[model samples]
Target: MLGFINGFLRRRQRERLRVAEFSSYWLEILKTNVPLFNRLHSADQEELRWRVQVFLAEKQFEGCGGLTITDEMTVTIAGHACLLLLHRETDFYPELYSILVYPSSFLVPVKRDFDDAPGIVHEGVDVLCGEAWPTGAIVLSWDEVCQAFSDDRDGTNVTLHEFAHLLDMEGGEADGTPILQDHEHYREWAKVFETEFTHLRRARRRGRLTVLDEYGAEHPAEFFAVATEAFFENSSVMKQQHPALYGELKGYYQQDPIMWLSRSDPVK
Candidate 1:
């Protein structure tokens, strides 16, 4: 009963925040920074606005690497993040409460084990644009975010890539599997993802170009995130080149970007 009461209270609070009017200034920020926002249907645009408002209200933003967080930065990040939740019923990333932003790619320390040595490891630094922790925070580079919007169809958005990790992590692990509606769906998801992942790995080994990025070959979690970036940014190409993968993503995201794009550009 106590747990239920807390959940209920939280839901009410979220609802109140959702109902609060979003300022026109933030709306303009989204319009100016995010080209994808202008492509969404009117209804979806309205829904996204509410979701962004709730997200901005719920999640805390902090600046790093001499970057100062601003309303434009907050709205731009939240707007893209909220795009994933547009067609779904969600608690708005229940495990995420904070976002950390950097001016550009940030360096993170990494330790790698040597294959020849039994337990010896080498420490190094990796420059990364974004990262999402399982149940805590998301870190991103503001420059990358701006570049993603400017590129628009490059199938690379640091924001979407990291948030996809958050979605995959919802099942308590980030092994590329997210919570599905049923057992049958899970079976199909596993089958399709495995097949595509293997195919991409093989393609990379052979030095062949593929619709999905080669970075997806790194891990299953990365595959899902990279595929998500492609699913939204290069939907038409994905639908044409990898129909099965596109179908599954369409089912999961509950939106048809191909159709949306066609509607937006009927001429071609």
Candidate 2:
């Protein structure tokens, strides 16, 4: 009973936030920084705006490494992150609460055991532009976020990449699979992703240029994130090169970005 009450109250709060007055300044920031925003249809653009409003209202943003958070930064990041939520029944990344932003790439300590070594573990720091924590925070580099949003077609979006991890983590662990809409869809999803994942690994081994980046071959979770970047940013080429993969993403996301691109006016 208490759980239901809490859920209802949260929904009411979010409904108010969704209909709250959105600042023209934030809208302009999205217009100027997020190229994908200009490509969306009018209806989708409005949906995105509502999602962003709720997103910014519910989530916390903090600056790190001598950086200061601003409306422009929050709006742009929320705009891109909410792109993943469009046209879907979402909890707005229920596990995520805080977003930590850095001015540029940051180094994170890493520790991993060699697959063949029994007791030896290697420890090091990795240079990362973004990361999604299972502990309820997503970290991003502000510069990389701007770069990805500026190009909007290079299939390299740190924001999308990390947020994709968050989506995968919603399934309880990040193994490349996200919570699907139906129980039966999991069978098809597994088949399609397995086939494509194998294809990408082979293509990387052969040093062949592919629409999905080679980095996707690293792991299933990374592949999902990379594929998401390509889904929104390089939709046309992805549709052409990996039709099955594109179809699954299209169905999962419930948005055809290619159609959006084809039907929309030139991006400003």
Candidate 3:
């Protein structure tokens, strides 16, 4: 009787968590906001909306610089950030405690914080974008962040970059590695990343045009960031040009964005 009672309590707790995670506020946000952007498939968009609802519930966001954080701000950030976890078995971002949002461009004083365990010399990233830290905070500028969803096609999204940083940190280290279900997955990840990484480096050197930009060659770390941008924006083009790389990304992200494109897509 005692053992049965313990099992019942555990099961009840899990059920409650599921209900809380997929709560009413989250469902409403998704129902309204997701259809605005046709970039995601109905399924992927639904997944993102659900994940964001759950993420906002779990994380803490502090509004700074006299900006009052509202429900819109919370939902916007959560929706995009949750896209990063749509395919993962676990949305393992518990290491992040707080999110700091500035109304516009904010200067980050330069400093180096090196992690000897990973031989990573963390340089203080400056300028007008976003930054994510392993087990640290993710920072965003709300002013620049809105462009990520603009109907006009641009090659950059600061939120996506920082969020990509969060995704990369999932392996408990940020050396361009994220969670993979198997050793076989790592072998493929390494090979495709190295080859495409070298291609981007060569293109940048020779002043030639390429799909994967020069920013990718900055480091293996930056490669992950740039690749993520390409993954969401120009997926079909990337797939056509780099079949093997596309295949790996499809597996890693667990979303085949190429299928999201339609015959009527004028940009394609």
Candidate 1 per-residue lDDT over residues 1-268, each given as its tens digit? 9989988987888778667877889888888787788788878888899888788878999999899999989999999999999889788999998999999999999999988996998999999999999768999999999989887788888999999999999988999988875678998999999999999999999999887899999999999999999999999899898999999988888988877675654221
lDDT of 3 by residue, 131-181 (tens): 787766888888877666553134456676788878788776776777787
Model 2: lDDT equals 0.91
| Superposed Cα deviation of residue 114, candidate 3 (Å) | 16
Q: Give lDDT tens digits, candidate 2, residues 11-56.
A: 9988887678878998899898888888887788888999998998
What are the lDDT scores of the predictions, listed in order?
0.89, 0.91, 0.70
Q: Who is ahead in TM-score, 1 or 2?
A: 2
Instruction: Tell me the deviation in Å of residue 263 in model 2.
Output: 4.0
Q: Pick the candidate with the highest TM-score.
A: 2
Model 3: ten consecutive residues of lowest lDDT: 29-38
- Per-prediction TM-score to the true structure, in the order listed: 0.95, 0.96, 0.79
Per-residue error for 31 in candidate 2, Å, reads 0.9
lDDT, candidate 2, residue 41?
A: 76
Better of 1 and 3 by TM-score: 1
Off by over 4 Å in 3: 1-43, 111-125, 263-268
Q: Candidate 3 — what's its lDDT?
A: 0.70
